[model samples]
Target: MAHIKSRKHPAARRLNCSAAVALAFIALPGAIHAQQTKPASAKAATEATLPEVNVQGQAQSYKSDQVSSPKFTQPLVDTPQTISIIKKEVFQEQGATTLTDALRNTPGVTMLIGEGGNSSARGNISMRGFDTAGSIFVDGMRDLGNFPRDIYNTEQIEVIKGPSGSEYGRGAPSGTVNMSSKTPFAGNLNAGSLSAGTDKQKRATVDLNRKLNESSAFRINAMAQDSGIPGRDVAKNKGWALAPSFAFGLNTPTRIFLNLEHIEQRNRPDFGVPTVGLPGYYNAALAAKGIVPPSKVNPKNFYGSTSDFENVNGDMVTARIEHDIRPGTILRNTTRIAKVQHEWMATAPSGAVSDGSGSAAVARPDPNTWTANRSRQTKWQKNELITNQTNLTTEFKTGSIAHTLSTGVEFIYEKQLSKTIAGAGTMSPANLWNPNPSDPISGYALTPNGAQSKGDTMTVSLYAFDTLKLSEQWQLSGGVRFDRYSTENNNVMVDGVRTRLKSSDTLAGWKLGALYKPASNGSIYASVSTSQQPPGGSNFTLSATDTNINNPNLEPQKATNVEVGTKWDVLDNKLAVTAAVYRSENTNDLTTRGADPGQIIQYGKKRVSGVELGVVGNITNQWAVSAGLAKMNTKVVAGSATQTGSSLNWSPELTFTAWTTYKLASGLTIGGGARYVDGMVRSVSNTANAATTNMLNVPSYWVYDAVASYNVNQNLALRLNLYNLFDKEYVASLNNNGNRYTPGGARAALLTANLKF
Candidate 1:
């Protein structure tokens, strides 16, 4: 949940469910033979048998045929819903070092400019018209904290869109993002990368694997980086991380795995620039009297001083065991413990330049000596978590029907502690146009005052999924899950009074799907799914006030999704094409009172309907491509005036993403891609189509990136990445309040040397 702060910077969290997956691979041969059973006399005689099965050719590296989760019984093409996966090779080739950067490969997802420090949510994000900040997972477990995520130790990232409460215990109504970790395997090798680039970007990484024996292996990965944002002054990122994993019984029926991770980050967080001149920008001070139109400030200006900083420490330990009970059955158990601590002090710039004494608040007013007043924000937070999961997967036959079933039980405990630092006094204003990072900032907040909070959640979950192959061309799938959770909260107000609240409930969710095969390599499917989100289930905070949505007494919000789609593999099984038309409807159980004043309502509804198309894999042996496009229609079926409209805040109507690469026979490769986001409305101070005193809508923009690499030898290569190739200037994202916005990256380059042994 949002309240938990990690102990430090985040590192790789892998080997989640690895032990069981490895055991299944080792038992594959026996599984095929276990299906046979006969009387001794009949078995001895020459008898009928199943035909041998053989699969030829390898899938392209840019495409993934299957997902890491055990719940899905079919390949990505045969599955009923849409799933977007970004493999390590893809992001690495693009020089995408963070989770946000890598996610650009997928459409229908948008990032949010986070709110103020006093907010409980961190690293806000939206997908399919819903907030998904709390639905990010690592190795099948929730990953806490709202900060930039590194990808050095990640294998792949999978985005499962739509209501999937039956797949995971609790999550956002939109969807979930799961990151698979890299674990030790039966291999021996060493590899790494060293890079230096513009904006003082310098980075180094190392990966080493050692084989202890035929059945055991150990691996470790480490990364260090020091970088600054292009076109932005004083904003920096510095971090180091290490992940180590050990595996035993790689070829046996039973396997064991242990994984550990740690990371430290000392960074200067960006607060973004003032949105004073963007289209739709409105200012109360000037709107009534019609003062000089505001002047556009430089997007590169640094609004924060050198004292602004964000320090993080994150650590995790995981242990797992898996056993092959029979040729067709697997039993797996995994346990993990993680701790994270985060703290930050930063400045938030607001409004046009003001001299703090009544001078006309305008950019470069008179002699351009005007200064902008900035608000100081500070917080300290920590998060602690532990979880245990056990699962069973088996294949069986009931008369003429064949089935694959997966069942699991899980236990979790999580806690978050947060403290707000009170400012000692007001901060001196800084020059609006030419802000100086060296400007001395005094009276900043350092120590915590009376404002504090502590939240805890405990959960027990049971889930089962089954797929029935009715015939060669027909399949039916269904899943059910129940979660019994308890939450408690403690808050201390500014007056030093502590208040405690607790809530408990049981939530149920289910999904159903059917598939029909038109040919050997194509399928058409239809599905229905449902999910629920309880009050405080995402943010981890409970309220006693009757009007607050997080009040424990409120009922859980509900969501339902309906979809029809088709998938196919073409071009000699080297390429995949998919299309889906779907609708998702969510009904929020209000706080016994409507969001609008002087009104009451039991339920409010919202809907998002869209069509999505995707293509991935290879057009030829030498060329690879991954692309997706989505057109969405969002509407507030019933809600407050500000929230009821055809367009939801931050939800764009159309988005597209594509990346392609062609390999040359000379050991050289080159690729480039473009992304587009439609203009988004700001619903905070204005209606869906009306204007306000601030930027009512963010302008649509397109950005381009390219990469090229040349192999010097079998073990060494040189690579270069160019970003924002056209140097497009646009707003990347804006805060919900519409006062601040982050600028898109300017033209930049990075040169790297890759090594392997």
Candidate 2:
């Protein structure tokens, strides 16, 4: 495993649609209003100003769409970096009911499997070549740890790539993803959806909004889903999530808002299709007859009534308050606390096929029986994270220039507890199968009875930033942050190998950025940032010779990045285009070597450079297109040459994605899109010419999708979605033993109906 460099990535959002798709269709109402209003009436209304655009879920002092004011929609062009946003409307339109499903089409983003049943392995969004676990943010606050993320209350997802120590605390060398929750509205917005699809998949979602008073409101949302895997091993997996939120505006220059969310997601991890081998990636000659890759395996299983995966549950509470000191200076504060617990287990063959390879040398049969062996993995994790942040903004006039200065500070604390139970056994080839109807595989148990290991760690951080307006056409921003993170753990091995580990790390990181708004709709900017990675307690596990190499005295990893970009608004805000090129270098990156008990060492350096182009908003009133292209080149600058120049695991060099929606008539619309990834090889060693003979390189491929919707009325609609239209064959998996390859699945379709009143 190569060093895991840090890079910022996109945040988890409820919707998958791009900004362009929403802007295109949203303009219909304004167009209709114009046609219905007479010239005289329009003139009177424009002069009198009926009312302001009430921005939902914001403090009273903050107005909506203030060109010179700070707002969530202020756009990434305002900063000297790369930014992209995915709104909630897109999610509903595309029927993206889950976080994982929604991220598939996000620009320059890739999902990385953590491998094994480790709760920390559930899901990760990677940028460049760095893991983004600690780089994720919810509602502009830190929620980082070893827990998986869910989108039960998210309204929109924002992606900021490159080093962002300016806004985020000690962060990722890659980038950050911000999850923004849906705010409360003053009016009534009652919307609900019911969806049913193949494999007994059923789901129901409802959102209720009500105005509590002239200046207060509340919104409650709940969702329940039960679904089965459709293909080969269709295991029954289901769960439910709930979110409730409220907002208030005080007449005495004060405001308060609260949001609570509880999520329980219990789904089976597709450990993978039984790998006997099927050509393309898996060696067909090695696979059992009629066995399909895990990707193609039907969700329904033929084995038994149980699944071989794990169970995950998460709970969170978020709150904020805002106060206006004067017309120009205002103070805003926010806090969030969340806890997540997970238990996962899986049964796999010792000789599995993964990473498009088939040597099977990493996994040999139990010496006694030249037959297959069985292995089991069990892991549990409990994590809690809390963040507190405050910001102050003021306006001043200098000569002919109007300057609005903003400053803020952030404090974060995170705690993580983890345990693991693992072992393997050799079985008589014949006894591997369930022979009797009375007894079926109920999943494997821990190898050593009562064998469990536990460890915990805590991290604390503090930081601040400032944004300056130099002139109406120019904005300059710069910020600095500092963090002090530490961890401690206790582990008792079943064989009396008791170990107590205590490790603490303290580091300071900062960034500088400048934005020049040459015009009202366009800007050019540049930024430089830094990030660090701490050594975990697990680093204590090492061989005698490797102990020195894995020195607990290991320092935090470091990375620096510089980027330049330009943003433009074309056709009067109907189209927004952004382009950026960046170069990042990592020093003392933490990477694993060898299998299972891989030695953790800071021994690799990498350089990554890439150019990305994104276009959002509408191309025309009736036709909208959202497209993005990312070309990244990665090289191991100071390590073994073999793995250096090769693209890192899960880092595809060329990525292309686009979605287009055309409004056919009044309330009818159709949309379709496709995503493609170029081929890349997975390297796991620090030596040049590191044995490619037995390695596997996933081939490039595309996944096509289409959707159609009919607006039955003002508040009701029907939508249908088709995924993998061609049933393309490709593997989107990564793991150890190199034995977890899955053939891309065949076509699948779903339908949903939404009702709003």
Tell me, what's the RMSD of every candidate?
A: 9.1, 8.1
Candidate 1 residue spans exceeding 4 A from truth: 1-60, 116-122, 292-294, 353-370, 589-596, 684-692
**Model 2: CA > 4 A from native:** 1-74, 116-122, 144-149, 230-232, 250-252, 274-309, 349-374, 397-405, 422-460, 537-552, 590-603, 684-695, 742-745
Which candidate's lDDT is highest? 1
TM-score of each: 0.89, 0.80
Q: Tell me the whole-model lDDT of each prediction, alpha carbons only.
A: 0.79, 0.60
Estimate, for each residue in 266-337, the C-alpha lDDT of model 2 and write its tens digit. Answer: 776554432233233443322333333333232222322233556778888888888989986778888888
Candidate 1: minimum summed lDDT over ten consecutive residues — where?
4-13
